[model samples]
Target: MPEYRAPLADFEFLLHDWLNVSEHYAQIGKDDIDADLVNEIITQGARFAESEVAPINQIGDQQGCTLKDGKVTTAEGFPQAYQSYIENGWNAMLGSEEYGGQELPYSVAIPVHEMLVSANVSWRLVCGLTESAVLALEKHGSDELKETYLPNLISGEWTGTMNLTEPQAGSDLSLLTSKAEANDDGSYKISGTKIFISGGDHEWTDNIIHLVLARLPDAPAGVKGISLFLVPKMLPDANGEFTIENDLSVGSIEHKMGLHGCPTCVMNFDGAKGWLIGAPHSGLACMFTMMNDARFQVGLQGTGIAEASYQGALTYAKERLQSRAPQGVQQPDEKADAIIHLPDVRRMLLTQKALTEGSRALGLLYAKQVDIVRFGTEEEQAKAESIVAYLTPITKSFFTDMGQEVSQHGVQIFGGHGYIQEWGMEQLIRDSRITQLYEGTNGIQALDLISRKLVRDGGRMLQNTAALFSDMINAIQNEADKNMALEIQQQWLAGSESLMSGDAFDTASRAYDYMQFCAYSLLAICWLSMKDRAAQTGNDQLASSKAKTCDFYIKRLYPRALMHKAALGDSGEDLAALSLEDF
Candidate 1:
């Protein structure tokens, strides 16, 4: 069976050495988060994840969630584990201080979140969804709504959910038939059946705060008619406590391929009392504040799962006796050598490490950009937002794809046992499959990257992205491996220019390849940055490992970027010309 151990050293290297997050926090007026405090949080959070959360992963997968009498009961120990999480104040760490939270920077919260996900992704979604809900309510919720909802939600006494997908409205919100009628008491009667609601209903808490997207009676047609609402399962009465049950119930829970512990529900809100959030017909905008945050968090899901898979595979490789090393017997005393001595096993393990570490770095770096967008100086805020907007789709799609790839490699290293659940490699693969599907399918993310972000702005954001990398490379021009950095920057710029020059269909057709190209190139930047920092520290072991990994990435993985660039150059005409009739 697989076990989880948080990658504290890698996180410390990224947060303290590579990204200099402490300086970042100080710059953003977050003077409270010093290196010592940050290390303590990472250590304690890891302890909770490994001890309290990880043990429940396999149990949850087997037992799943039970739905009965319109109430969903999570897997055994889930509620207790969650209560522990709340008691430890994990949920309130990232929220606003105005709502009884610590208001730590995303840079800090993101690592803690990564640990939670790596330890137990199924359980992580419970609070993960609430974090997004908090973002939406804080950004768009009225003062009254915030006063009532924010305190409890931030304190983790109550949980939250985002209701967007219905049976008819899969990805298209225009087909949503959910209705909201204005009530005489200044509330709206939200009546709808929302499907695919993660953590939609659970007995873990007394109240579940739902952020629903519904249309007002006289609202405009299609998406323009949509409005955001805060609908709680149990409405609060005087003194802001759960005093009355709202008209909502769990219709059913999804028997999904994985994440069975989260209790994805088909929620039926029949005339549920809800308060409007933000202006009418501006629901999409409000919900996006949640979606963007969730999208990046979903990306972290991929990184976390991949890290766990890699660790499991590594442990197995070191223990499972196999064929002798190519050169000689690695373990003469034993009948067979450990698989870790094999070349192919090393390749698989190295790929997992490279991708997992790179993805973690990119995710946290993206989170730092989020911090800047929220609290940086005005000029810094504008620049960071532009950069983050350009990278969001890349973060979501690329990281998830890498997760899938790394998880697959994990299973492969285990050979036959990996296909079976007893070893736990299969569970990682099953759980990670949804990361690519939900939070917007990776294909859709690719299309969005091409049509909306890269091409729509006439390449302004893409140019800004190229410039951002170029500046980083320029900053390290005097370093030992500066030439390699310059070469990567030039190649990225060339690829960006070529993709932007294409037409809509041309760009769309090559969007997936282009996304991969950009993801790999950016990861190269991360690896090289770490390489330079390691070289400077005179830590021979760390420097050697970074150098070997950097060389492997460049020599093996980096060549794929060249192939993608070549693929991107195709007009996609031959591919497009083939019609459904051709099949």
Candidate 2:
């Protein structure tokens, strides 16, 4: 299949007519970023993603990566396409203007990422890791590290990866045994073997930078004693340019069920030259610098997948001829008009549209918050950070699970075409599954929702957002509306206390209802927010799409919030009662 034609009209509605992207731009001192620039970028990024990247997706998967000797070579066409993407500055869109980055609003950057990922997500993993590496380094690394690393990384000339997982330590970082020995030169020799390292070894860039988490020689046991290190594939000298190969090599890459385009390497480090990124024994917090971004990007991964799947399903429903109308002849022409003419198929397609579009709106909405938190003045910064902190994990976990469910539904809508590899429907399913697993699994995400996010700070965060949801819920629904969104807000608000407790894990699940409630709530608010502006500006089509999607989200898709409410309450002594013997 060709790359998706991004629903640009729908997206435009989400950003300008629905979401307050421009308002946030003004808040961040980028009031100059009008709708025109944003639209152009969306157009260009979509063209580049659909044309330059989409073709190579199946090629990358079919050819995978070749590891002969020590070098990791990507599938054919990858290097060339990567160069084109770099030459076009696709890699530097959201980079700091202090460096060479365009410093475009994150509002614009996220949608660009969604375009690229929706086109070819697995092939784009290296860029996500690169973005994450820049985030971690910019926030915590020394000035020397920042000056040397940020420019190249922001430009994508040098790629980056986070090395944290050991064979014995996947979710549990406490067991990692990587060692960083002091060299008396403000450096260390890091020796560790990290598994499941995406972009761990690649020839697309001149050099590879790794932020490794390792323990010191005299460090205490477990995660607290661990520290973050900046380890490069090649050692840099006086000029901050690589001069010699570092003592790290790729051991192997995992053969996963999907995402074959990305090389998840088994990295073996034999005293790799390393520099500590943050304070000694503070690796976990340092890794969080990247983890949060990585998690949100993973959420977008789900959004992109869901969007792609929805597009595929919508296209299939419109074209594939199937049974006659159920309500006695809605399609009287030829053998059949299309499955889309059927109400049931329309139901599935609408559900996908409602959730996928809602998810996209949430991601962009958060990106705007990122701008405010990073660049806003004192008063707004506090509020923006609070909102970002509040929404980050929900975006990650919710969107990922959405990708899995929506993609599976896409497969189902295709029936047999979904099952076969030729149609590429199965590929979507295979590709989206990893979103839940990578960047912390959905299980880890739910725990985070229960722990740091929902409950911490004495439940103040959850309580604060209740007002935002309530305001959106109060929006009037006309006779034309069919979605049940207000009911969702009622359910989520009612269950806020339970969600704040450890019992929250029992409250929600892998189904993403609670998460979706939050995600779609943001969507509804963003759309409604934009609608207020659109009505004044006289853009009816854009405003109408917003209204329809919002209504569709509430009545058609928001009911999942009901299921999540039940899911949360279901976590009880019964779940804990089952033991190994019972199983």
Best candidate (score: TM-score): 1
User: Which tens-of-lDDT digit does each residue in 294-410 have in candidate 1?
Assistant: 999899999999999999999999999987899799899999999999999999999998898888988888888889988899998888888898899999999899999999999
lDDT for predicted candidate 2 compared with the true structure:
0.79
Q: Tens digit of lDDT per residue, candidate 2, span 399-516?
A: 8888888998898889888898767778988999889897788877766665666766666667656654555445534312213345445556667665655544354442344565
Q: Using Cα atoms with residue i matched to residue i, what is each candidate's TM-score against the true structure? A: 0.98, 0.92
Return the TM-score for candidate 1, rounded to 2 decimals: 0.98
lDDT of each: 0.89, 0.79
Tell me the spans in candidate 1 whose CA falls farther than 4 Å from its real position.
238-240, 477-480
TM-score of 2: 0.92
- Clashing residue pair totals per candidate (backbone < 3 A): 0, 8
Instruction: Return model 2's CA RMSD, one decimal.
Output: 2.9
